[model samples]
Target: MCRTSILPSTVKAVKRGEAGSAGELRGDFDLSGDLGPLYANTGSGIFGRLEEAPRAGAAVPVGMALPGPATILANVRGDEVREYDIEILKVAPSSADGRDLVLSVTDPELLEETGGIVQGMSGSPILQNGKLVGAVTHVLLNNPEKGYGILIDHMLEAAGDGVD
Candidate 1:
């Protein structure tokens, strides 16, 4: 397979809204880059011993990193506000082409408590369609609930991927 190497520093966090805003929060992530080899030892048979390496530059496509100082559009209860530091473990290809992306969150508690996805989970980078698809935008934060994602194309197109 392909072998890619990404530095840990590649990742960055995107904050949402101002601290004093009505709805404000922030999310952390590991930027896309050349990730080292990921072992695939199933222990099924002798062949399982084979160590598989990732493709070179296997990180999510360029321009996928969500911009900083993002706005979190989420509904909160009471006046209790909390922020979380999220780690993006993996970004892989999706079945669809340029239409859908697959993103894996490292924290299971967040997933279990919030179902599939949760609030403040938006703006998370998803990797699929061979490019930076978008970021998580919303979440149910309740039963049978999942999170929502927004296409990066529009954000990038509007922001121009450059800050003044």
Candidate 2:
């Protein structure tokens, strides 16, 4: 689960629906998960065992994250997941609260469509060099184009799933 105040007993994720812009909800999902405290919930992200796991992707060390070209997989509108271009502006490997990747949205289509980063885009995968590096965590309210991301390493560490 992404960072949110309300943790309901059940979470209904988006599966299929019409696309939407900022401040609007889109998509639909029949898949739902039952909440339990056994899951690892931390400042970085939430991790839990699913009945059927999704295929695992290549993982990259967070230390490799730098100021360079990258892409974020996000479902900003409807159920269509698209890869949006982004620039890794800065990296804080030592960040304690998961604000490791400082990035900006540069994709013209994403910028024009959703007006940069908006709500419900958190936990979007940040991929670089064909590897998973981090996840979008928060967006700059004053400048939606800018935002912070949590390093995948940090998330894995928080979940006690791996070690350096």
Best by lDDT: 2
- Per-residue lDDT of 98 in model 1: 22
**46: Cα error in model 1, Å:** 49
As for model 1, its CA RMSD to the true structure in angstroms is: 16.7
Worst 10 residues of 2 by lDDT: 3-12
lDDT of 2 by residue, 29-111 (tens): 43354332346667988666544434454444454577899999987654467899999999998876768989899999877
Clashes of each: 18, 3
What are the TM-scores, per candidate, against the unseen true structure?
0.33, 0.72
Q: How much does each candidate deviate from the true structure in C-alpha RMSD?
A: 16.7, 6.4
lDDT by residue for model 1 (42-63), tens:
1110011113453344555534
